[model samples]
Target: MNAISSYLGSDHTRCDDFFIQAETNVSNGAWEQAEVSLAQFTEALERHFTMEEKVMFPEFEQATGSSAGPTAVMRMEHQQLRSIVALMRDALAARDAESYLGHSETLNTMMQQHNMKEESILYLMADRVLSGRQEEIISAMTSIDAPA
Candidate 1:
């Protein structure tokens, strides 16, 4: 009986770990390691987003019959995060540590706020409304392919 909160909350931690590793590598001027860590972070984050957008959000919307609520807001925030990640990627490519760190700071702030909303509100709501189907939804989320 694993709740959506637990499943996705753990994923948040997983992504955060990757992000921290990437940021630390970049800070140390370990370009090669930074590249690898950043790639890992990006992949983990994209997978987390996909699981929510493709699986959990749809299920929650369908069950609740409200597509323009929290899911919409989360989607918008995801786009914002993606844009920041793109900037970080560009900075990384140019070996601009200052720029990359700046973007990383913004991204870290955004991710904290976004994850708070999800864990506090949306996920709790989903757990209540989509109770019995948690396993099914979690399974689907787990099976989704990582983003390119």
Candidate 2:
């Protein structure tokens, strides 16, 4: 299997599952559980994004002898995500279910968009540009822990 299919699939699966758990907690009005679940959800995102920004993206950029395209956009999206994520903590603290759900949906959309781009375009590019680090990239991501 290609790196995109072979690697990112598992990570995305777990992360998405966590997102659903967080959503459930919020839907049930379990603010405390939702808070913790959100934290765990964020951790999973951080772990995956960190691995990409630190390792895979750089390597792909280097391999292609350029760094001004897809990776840049991904970085920008990450910033947008962080901004929304910050608001989540406050919403959670206030037990503002509406606000919390809105933020969670925003985060979910961001992740879905980001993942779609990464898996469809970025990972394919990496599969082409990166020569020898397919397994390494995958392993790095796999080893990184989600929040809880």
What lDDT tens digits, residue by residue, belong to model 1 across residues 56-131?
9999999999999999999999999999999999999999999999999999999999999999999999999999
Worst 10 residues of 1 by lDDT: 138-147
In terms of lDDT, model 1 sits at: 0.96
Q: Model 2 over residues 30-124: C-alpha lDDT tens digits?
A: 88888788788788778877877877878788888878999999999988987888888788888887997898888888888888888888888
lDDT of 1 at 58: 95
- TM-score of every model? 0.99, 0.88
Which pairs in model 2 have colliding backbones? none
Per-model CA lDDT versus the true structure: 0.96, 0.79
